[model samples]
Target: MQIVTRLIAMTRARKLQRQFQLIERSIVALPVRTRSRLAIMTLREVGQASKCEFPHLYGTAPEQRYMPWGQGTEIGFSRAQSDNAEVALRGIALWLAVAYHETKESPYTSLQPQHRQLLRVLRELRDAGAERDAMAQWMRSGAAA
Candidate 1:
């Protein structure tokens, strides 16, 4: 019985290790911008839930109204305005990546139309070099634009 229990425990541990490795691979496979966005969104959710203020992670409200995360007012213009376009792009990517992982569904199958649209827009920005240009400008100006 002891040997059986030990074997079961070892199997469970190996399974858990594989699961963690899979998640790590998924995260690493994601683009840097997407990872950044994921980190920011995760931080924002945690901060809000815990009522902890993270000024670095949080941004001031945007002049134009827009939903940064596609679903909630909780994550919006502040992130885009505070962080650069790359950060915003990353956040959007992260949001999609997380959604994909959690749902285990394709973006078209699992995500709402709005989210799909948001993803499209962000992807366009990334592909067009707009995000890179904006980041470069931000760096050159030494100020958030």
Candidate 2:
């Protein structure tokens, strides 16, 4: 039945949320500097996969959440086209935000237009699929589209 199929898909989506939360909790427990590095690395990876420049996370409301200033890396974003990049980009963005609370390096960071889109994505990381209301919130983030 259509109802049954919808329920199954919903179940999987919620499960994915929970799994991501578990990942976030584990990642946040690491040292702050390590978390920061990982966050930057995640940003670069997300941008690379999305076919955009790396996101500037420092100027946003959330700001970069640590210490010792992360050294800058100048890597060009280029790749032979691939259809699967979008999938990787989304997951990378979500994971970065999960650790974003630990970000804390600056002096050359400012939000790009795509970064605003990223902020919307970050907003969905909350609630961790703990309730129906939270699940609805995730649905609104357009992550499933």
Candidate 3:
């Protein structure tokens, strides 16, 4: 019984790891500007669903709150409300997408300070090696146009 339970847990972990890897690869393949836009849109959608007032945080508002990644124009959560894991995960993914989009010079270069921080957080959410490998592979593929 113990072995069976351990095997199930390991299988689930592997499945989740694969899912995260796929997400990293897909985001890396997206155009930089498109990924930035998607991050902004995801934040807006998540905020609206969570009932966070965003009169100044959506749709080209000059004072809108945004993540530090990209041009710093993407909307972001104002406060850490609710302990929902899904919302947190979406926010992390959005940040990762934006960072990955910006650092397109090379897999090992051109990452700004903010991008590094965002990548660190993303790696914390999943496997850092897997995320890096996906990004590297995408860069080599030249499909980020």
Best by TM-score: 2
| RMSD for each of the candidates | 16.1, 20.0, 16.5
Q: Model 1: residues >4 Å from true position, as ranges?
A: 1-6, 41-140, 143-145
* Error of model 3, residue 8, in angstroms: 2.6
Q: Which residue pairs clash within candidate 2? A: 65-103
TM-score of each: 0.29, 0.34, 0.30
Expressed as tens digits, the lDDT of each residue in 1-145 for candidate 1 is 8677556545533433343344344445567666545555554543452341322223323433242222222243223333475555443433433332222222323233333544453354345355655676788894864
TM-score: which is higher, 1 or 2? 2
- The segments of candidate 3 whose C-alpha lies over 4 angstroms from its true place after superposition are 1-5, 44-145
lDDT score for residue 109 of model 1: 30
Query: Per-residue error at 102 for model 2, in Å?
Result: 23
Give stretches of model 2 more than 4 Å off.
1-5, 52-145
lDDT winner: 3
Residue pairs in candidate 1 whose N, alpha carbon or C atoms collide under 3 angstroms: 33-90, 37-90, 37-91
